[model samples]
Target chain A: MTAPSQSPIYDRVALIGLGLIASSMGHAMKKWGLARSVAGHARTAETRAAALELGFCDEVFETAAEAAKGADLVVLAVPVGNMGALAEEIAPVLKPGATVTDVGSVKQAVIEAVAPHIPNGVNFIPGHPLAGTEHSGPRSGFATLFANRWVLLIPGEAAPDAVAKLRAYWEAMGAFVEEMDAAHHDLVLAVTSHTPHLIAYTMVGVADHLRRVTESEVIKYSAAGFRDFTRIAASDPTMWRDVFLTNREATLDILGRFTEELFMLQRAIRMGDGDMLHDYFTRTRAIRRGIIEAGQDTAAPDFGRSVTGAGE
Target chain B: MTAPSQSPIYDRVALIGLGLIASSMGHAMKKWGLARSVAGHARTAETRAAALELGFCDEVFETAAEAAKGADLVVLAVPVGNMGALAEEIAPVLKPGATVTDVGSVKQAVIEAVAPHIPNGVNFIPGHPLAGTEHSGPRSGFATLFANRWVLLIPGEAAPDAVAKLRAYWEAMGAFVEEMDAAHHDLVLAVTSHTPHLIAYTMVGVADHLRRVTESEVIKYSAAGFRDFTRIAASDPTMWRDVFLTNREATLDILGRFTEELFMLQRAIRMGDGDMLHDYFTRTRAIRRGIIEAGQDTAAPDFGRSVTGAGE
Candidate 1:
């Protein structure tokens, strides 16, 4: 069911990490009145102070347990590696019948790590918003971050009513919600996100290590194609490290397939096989058109001019 | 030295392929009076008609040789694969004392292919404007395309005066001009553009072939990282195919190094080497910052939002 036009989804919502996703959620909640009061907690005092200054929350807590004490909704918006430990720390203080969800990239590992510690009577759901900028920290978020973007919910054994309420809250906060199985979600994301991100990181790393091409030259001429990889590689390092660790199997599998495909293309290039390269390049072009038609991305060339003010 | 404020650098200029680069040059030349008259030619009648309709040229010719006739400067703006044939066709008509240059992606191959056919007294200078949008065709160009971008000139044996005049013309159109050797230019481009494009094409191809993850699912959830690859993969098939074929040695060499680096990352992932992954990702982020500081790209987190209207 859709959320009501002007009602708060929860009396108190606790954001356990004051990063991009958490802060965006707070802003969205405030903009849509999805929660009556927002509470935030981060390990760093500076982040907690910054969260309070940003005015996305009514109260800021120094500890995850303190944030979860009286909240009806607690969002574990931390890196995947920290989820288990945080779950254990907050387990004793979680309000009875409250819904606890997460915004971790990897699901199965998070569920296994956080599920046992999510005390009885609390609903534990794993979620991931398929939206982000190549930015992190409290200041890097906006209310519209999740607008028209997917927010997948892995309900596990959580109650239907809790799941429905959570879905309504996300929809009110501008996300299009979908129900998904945890394993399948991991595999799909590995193909769409994890493997691609690793590849971007690798390519950028390669450019960095090339001694012959001066770093200045690489950066100056990046608009040709490598700049896009740089953009993706610029994402938060901690979050990505945890992603590869937790989503190990799926990421490795997709990467294996990718290396195989790359070898084929490499062989074609070495042999000067114009027809094969042309055919492969031509095929990929159609997929790009499909993405445009599907409204996932724009048809604009995005030569990094508008983004960087380069051609001005 | 810069050309005088109101004087045209050339009495007549011919662009022998009215595609993105040629059309953009026409616009820039017209904007600044860089040339007194511009004539264009394209293989397709439709492109020639469209070029004439766009009014970027004083006249449009049906053949490359006709376009070259009597022009003081002629630009072979055709694909790398066609440079030899186009050069042969236009050689007989090329004016004496004319400077003939090209905007090919692979410089050495183009120099080898187009150099032999140049008539005596005609200057054959191979050049590449390190700027473009993913969009192709004569209609996809704008006057500001070359602004603040690098235009590398490889003057094999062209006269110094002719090279200086051509450099001034490019500067007049707002490009930072540099002189470089052809083989080196090709190697630099392989690292910066060609290999990155091939990797993008390969990644997109991998996603397309995944049966479990429907094409629509990949398109829907592309923002995680795959969308960037899609944008690069969307580049013109014919142009990219020619680039890989013509820049075979350098492309293969870089691709070899890329695979080796990728294998190391892959091994680190499989071994759950968080330290290694973190270190590598951290280094790449610095290069991205360098690119921003160098005025090559922006630190704007270009979430593909403003360009695509996706998040809006």
Candidate 2:
């Protein structure tokens, strides 16, 4: 059931990382009064200070255990690679019956890494908010980052009331919440997110290594198509490294499919098969329309970035 | 030397195709008084009618020859594959001192296809405006489409005066103009535009064909990274097909580099080499910053599409 407008969903919430997702959540929770007090912890003192100065947290702690000591909800918002270690450190201080969730991209690896360290009395649910900007860091977040976006939760053996409460908290923050299996979520994200990101990083890398085409030339003419690839490749490096390492199998599987299709198109190009190229290009156009119709993307041409600015 | 502000750069300008580039030029020329009369021709009557109704042209003709008759500047804005035929059709009617240019993506191929049909005294200059949205058609144009964008010109045998006049006209439309060689232009675009499009098309195709991940799931969760690919892949099939077919050598060269780099990353993933992935991703980030610093893109996170709308 929906809570009354502006009421607190949790008496105290602990954010174990002060990055884009966690900072955005802090802003949204504070702006909407979804939590009575927000406590944050960052590995770096600089990030903790910045988060407090940004006013997204009521208090900042030097260690994860200090942040989770008395909180009702604990969000492990660090990189996938650090999930297990962070979970271990916070395990001893997690209040009994408290809910622990995550905002990692790959669900299965995060579940495996963090689930073990979570205390038995603590309800552990892995989650991922299907939203982000290429920019990262504590200050790179805003209150509306989750508005109209999807937040998927994997409630593994967690009590219904805990899952429901977490879902209600996210809904209060203006996100559409959904429940999904960890394995399926990993596979789906590999197809939609991981593989695409890997491809973009590879393309940008290729451009960078091309000596004949000067870097200045690439930068000057990037508005053509490679500009979009650069934006995707510019995302947080640590986050992506962890993503590829943790979600290795699914990402490699989808990448294999991608390479196969790319070779087919490459063959068509080499053979001068205009018809096949035309047909393939035409078929892909329909999926773009589907995304717009599905409300996952804007129908505005170039995402309406023209004239005003460049596209994403 | 710059002409008087708002003065006509050419008495008559003929556009061979009423697509995005041609229609945008028509609108910009009229708005800025760069051309006294804008004449247009399209293969389809529906497009011709739409162009005329949109008030981007003073007259609409049934054929390219009729449209080019007595014009001082004729722009061949059709697909690369159709350039030779259109040039042949308009060759006889070209004025002795007229300048014939094109807006094709690939310069060398467009030059090869159309140069033979140019009259002895007519000047042929191949130009490409590095600006456009995924939207196509005669109606999907605006007066400011080329604002602050780059328009590359390859002045093969065009007289100094003729090239200068065209450059002045493009500058008046708010584009920064640069001169380049045909072969180099094709190669650079293969890296910046052609190869990227092929990769995006391939990625979207892979997503579409995956049985485990439904099409709706791909579309629903696209905001993670795949959304940008869809926009690039959604571009006009005919135009892109001609681009790949005509620029085969360069596209293949770049694709070769791309595949090599992709394989390297794939290996790193298999071996869980987080350092390699992190190093590669970090290097790519500099290119995006270079593009933004060069004014080719916006620094706004997610193209500032958060909350207000979806990124490109």
Best by DockQ: 2
In model 2, which regions exceed 4 Å deviation?
A: A1-4, A296-312, B1-4, B296-312
Residue-level lDDT for A296 in candidate 2: 34
DockQ of 1: 0.52
Candidates in order have lDDT scores of 0.84, 0.85
Cα lDDT, model 1, residue B33: 86
TM-score of chain B of each: 0.92, 0.92
Model 1: per-residue lDDT, tens digit, A1-312?
A: 223349898999999999999999998888888898999999999998898898998999888999999999999999999999999999999999999999999999999999999888999989998878767899987887776677899998899999999998888866678888999999999988898888888888888878888887787677778877888888888889999999999998999999999999988888888899899988999988887776735432222223421100
lDDT of 1 by residue, B131-219 (tens): 77667899987786776677899987889999999998888877778898998888888888888898989999999888988776787
Among residues 3 or more apart in sequence or in different chains, the pairs in candidate 2 whose N, CA or C atoms overlap within 3 Å are none
When only the first chain is scored, the TM-scores of the models are: 0.92, 0.92
Residue pairs with colliding backbones in model 1 are none
iRMS values in order, in angstroms? 5.7, 4.4
Model 1 chain B, poorest ten-residue lDDT window?
Answer: B303-312
Candidate 2 lDDT (Cα, 0 to 1)? 0.85
Best by TM-score: 2
